[model samples]
Target: MRNLFFLCAFLLLAVACKSPEARRPVQRSSGSFIKESAERNKKLYKKEEAIINKIIAQNSDKDFESNPNGFWYFYNVKDTLSTVMPKYGDVVTFTYDVKNLEGTTIVSEKEIGLQQYQVDQSNQELISGIREGLKVMKEGETVTFLFPSYKAFGYYGIEEKLGANVPIQSTITLRSIESSEEN
Candidate 1:
């Protein structure tokens, strides 16, 4: 009688510990979450593009005129530095001072040092504006090009610390310090 009582007690305890459902938390379907995020990103991209277009329209009347060969112009120089710009495979070194048209120093190379960038057809290393700017510069020329937010950061601002709605109408200036020597 005692043994039977002990076995029954053990079985009762085991049954009590068993869970009616699995031990893991129920997983949500990722497809729905991904779709929602993609829609949100598309909306944000459109908003950013609209702001950039507005800035481009405003700056269109500035000194530089857009040319088939160059990105954007600051002044109407027939022999713009871009006339001798580098090709995509060329490597170049440069110093730059990026500022708004209002002369707010957004970035300065004197404070940071010289920067080197390679011309990449694959859009791997440089922004489209910078690439366009470099295409029209000589080895020892200093040129300034303005980049609307669309050309600058677009819908996604600087990936690091710059938050959203940071105004895409800001300007940037770049100077070509040297052209790399070909081996």
Candidate 2:
């Protein structure tokens, strides 16, 4: 009886291991999550662009140099010592003070101390604005950045150590970015 049972189980296993053509057809949806996410991001980006434009119109006197990545920057202290900007994978040390366009201080170098940032794709600590802004800054330069919400904080505002949401749809200014390169 045991031999007969083993023979039956062997037969079942043989039937199960069929050719690929015998397998059930895979039904892949025509719609994709990536396409949906991209569409949502585009709407958010457009909203941020409008908000930044209004802020720029309000402060017409300040020369805000805009970038393709949605951040506007201007040098407060243009030092010629380091004319070359740091590239990806370069280690840059800097002190930064970030504030909202309404002039509310979000965080400062005094509170967080100087930071050593590696210019790369995976560093979430640096916002899209700061990361892109760094590409234009040279060592010993103090640059002020005015970036849209999409570049600075996205839909969700930054959460501080004190657990306060800094709020969104607000343009942010990097009050000071004093960067120095390490040999």
- The candidate that wins on TM-score is 2
Query: What TM-score number comes out for model 2?
Result: 0.66
Q: What is the lDDT of residue 59 in candidate 2?
A: 78
| Tens digits of per-residue lDDT for model 2, 1-183 | 999999999999999997667666588776788899889777766776676677778878777788876677667777667567766667677777677766567776587666677777345587777777777877777777777666666556656521222222222222333333542
Q: What is the lDDT of residue 94 in candidate 1?
A: 67
- Each prediction's Cα lDDT score? 0.56, 0.65
Model 2's C-alpha root-mean-square deviation from the true structure amounts to: 5.7
Superposition error at 74 for model 1 (Å) = 4.8
> What is the TM-score of each predicted model, taking all chains together?
0.49, 0.66
